[model samples]
Target: ENNEVVYELLADMGWTGDSIDLDSWLPVYCKARYGGCPAAMDSAWQQFRETVYSSLYSYPRFTWQTVVPDTRRISKLDVSDSFLQGVELFLSCADSLESSPLYVNDAIEYASYYLAAKADDCYKRALKEDSLGNRVAAMQQLDRSVEILLDVDKLLASHPLYRLEEWVDMARDWGKTDLEKDAYEANAKRLITTWGGFQEDYAARFWSGLIKDYYIPRMKLYFSEQRADLDRWEENWIKAPWHNTSTSFEDPLQSAIKLVERYKGE
Candidate 1:
């Protein structure tokens, strides 16, 4: 595992440590960015710069400079739904991780994007009435989503056992509606079956986490009639029938990957 992580880290940085490249784009770019540093500083600088570059312009129009959430504010906020939703937006945009640690570090960010957007809609309605009760409710949703993000982030970063499957089990144990449990089970199984290899590739990793852990399960809630066989369903939640987008990368996951690659290239 240690060697694998090292190899991946080096490959990501265009390092040959010893292999010959049949086709390489990262080397020249690496030279351009870090050729001036001392040998000892070169690798470190390259890693740092690579992370920053990927974080900003890797997807769509996302630039690393884009502001989302301040982690320091997590404890200070009133725990309102809208505020919590903002935290979700932060996680969705890949703001929680200090640098380009790994795609999973940004897991919460992606989850938050969906959750915060929904919470934001609720807050809009609550704004019309300006009722304390609605305001509190909205905040509660945001807070819950944030809490979930925190857990997912940690799982993605340090623990392989805490996969989406476990999340489904948690939902079931929480004694959610039968409809919810069924939906959760179906999606969790899909993730495990489709992309559970623990592969190091970012695309595979992101898809595994998002599809299995978040997207499909969330859809189950909308179907009041419990689905006995969710595997038979062919709906694409990322590009749901209700979502309208003129761009090919408008799908949230795709957009996020693009952003990551963009930042890496910089």
Candidate 2:
């Protein structure tokens, strides 16, 4: 119902199921949200710029459209009506351990994309309002965008299957006993790291402070700034430190292993 409400809001805001190019919109969004904070804006701008560049080498071209949720498919599966049916199907396939990995992996991908789509929709609305000079409306939409993203994070965290440790355990118990804990952790880390290479291009956001410390404050600055101060804002934002754009880095497998060990201790 909550998701439905959000979708309705997006529809009312003129979302037409079309793809939005994050490469173009992200800079604008970041400027609106973080323009006042030089440090924040620079960090965000660098990440966004790198993400766009990295997508050139990534297969299928990572873009907002690529991750947008298939509302048609989601609509077909009425969760309330099909809950029992889904449980029954799961029970029926309980013995099929071979397919467990496939199912779990697919679920992760689906959830990530769905959340990305929701966030993107909110972003588009925010952009529209900003363009129309509706500062308050734009701020509201931006806040909604971050709220939806944080909610998705919470939802994923609440689901056992979405947790890395749980996923590893499930795979290990399902006839992959040979899968070492370190290897499993490394694989999970790689999945997240790769997806996050393009500035959370695949909904790999893990930080909870993003909204409170960065996004909201930036939007506030944007709303507070006068038209005459826009040039100074841009100048300050551009002067912030620029991080390296290259994302061709190896996964921190050892760190992932340590994380797994700590999770086990907990």
Candidate 3:
């Protein structure tokens, strides 16, 4: 009976038949059951989703950089209009689930919310550290932001509901024979193109190369010199060659594929 209930809960999350990994889910199921029956599990899921949504939407449209006086110097990079729009779109998509369900499996949505919130928190901490003139601490927070945001694709690839490789493999297989693209193929291409295209306003990212090679180094350059003129320092830094090169800009779909491939090899 307990096993049956666990399976039923998995079914609710769209995992069915042999696709359900009981071993991976048993601990979560047991923990959920400790509170009560199936209702407990359902309530827990709802609470988790709600918490993620709330955290994501709690920040203003332009975020902490705009609100905080100290961060105004680097406000453009810290909270760009493009970054805010991407975040808004992400949050909006998550919120839409409340009124209209789209996907059969919402694990990807949950992961997206969790990752975006985590990245935002890291960015806020970085700004706080910068305001305090603690370059080392600020870089640490920025590193965390990179880690969190870059892991989003990994989460999607591994999660049962949104198996990135599986979808890619299936799409490739179908493309080999089918002249007409299916809905899944079309949707997948659209998501990749839309998120990965030249339009920077739609996609948000803090990938590994951009962080370690770019943002961290850029911050180092900022802190290397001791300047009395805060305004001049900021102005000079923004105009610096490294600053323009180190900006957080990349193809999201390509990054996702690279990470997915790395995961597969590992």
Candidate 4:
């Protein structure tokens, strides 16, 4: 989401002699992206820039990406609410903009961000339940959270740029032999999960393969109350053979539509 917007701004600055593009850049970028920048879309992006992208945030990775209960993971609802408003406004313009490939891509990403925030809400609740010694309730909420993450992966997979397959496949393709292939793939997975020493998930991404095969499974073990050596588990996964299969997917906008409808009321 930020990448496209930043690129748009940078590209515009490159062309303009003065190198100044502010709110005006958004509609022009939107028009170039979706073929037309309607008023609602303009407003949505305005809110997005003001609220979400206006400054740097301490946490780039999601709370669940920590893979453990953490006070730092507790996000303020106000920010999420503001971001959701932008998402809603963006989707409201879908009737006119949905046909654009860029719009479809952004729809999947924007709506996925909404669903991810909702899932993070459940993760926080699960942490609270666990703190209260309500194991059953905690487990239930954790299950729901991971379920949403898996679904988020599905929604993300609709776009080529967001798939974990692209990450791993690109790395593996760099190898000239099976050993090199495995080494490259392991390094690729390791970068996202365990980059050596105490930085598990420091570079975590909300990608399809990572969530389904990596994050969700790790979360399950974390909440299962079992004595799990997470470091060992993570290492095993990194060195293990690649198991994520790339699949055909629906149009991104269609996936976004179904996903947002399923979780919006939650």
- What's the candidate order when arranged by decreasing TM-score? 4, 3, 2, 1
Model 1: per-residue Cα lDDT over 141-252, one tens digit each: 4344334333333333233333443444564565478766666665544443333333211122222244323432533332224434443342343222121111212244
- Kindly indicate the candidate among 1 and 2 with the higher TM-score: 2
For residue 251, model 3's alpha carbon misses the true position, in angstroms, by 25
Supply candidate 4's per-residue lDDT for 174: 97
Please give each candidate's TM-score.
0.22, 0.30, 0.33, 0.89
> Which one wins by lDDT: 3 or 4?
4
* Candidate 4 stretches greater than 4 Å from native: 14-21, 69-79, 245-251
Question: What is candidate 1's TM-score against the reference?
Answer: 0.22
Give me the runs in candidate 3 sitting further than 4 Å from their true place. 1-37, 45-105, 158-266
C-alpha lDDT of residue 247 in model 3: 23
List the candidate 1 regions with Cα displacement exceeding 4 Å: 1-223, 234-266
lDDT of each: 0.34, 0.38, 0.39, 0.77
Candidate 4, residues 70-163: lDDT per residue as tens digits?
A: 4543333334566777888888888898778888788888887788878888887888898899999998889889888877888788776877
**Under the 3 Å rule for N, CA and C atoms, how many clashes does model 4 have?**
0
Higher-scoring candidate on TM-score, 1 or 3: 3
RMSD of 1: 15.9
Q: lDDT by residue for model 3 over 1-266, one digit each (tens)?
A: 11244365557577444465544564455344332223333443444434322233222222221222233122222232333333333333322232322221232333344454555567677778888989899878767665654565344433333333444346546564444334445454334222333431122222222233323343334434542443444344323222111122153333333433333211
Candidate 2 residue pairs in clash (backbone atoms < 3 Å) = 33-218
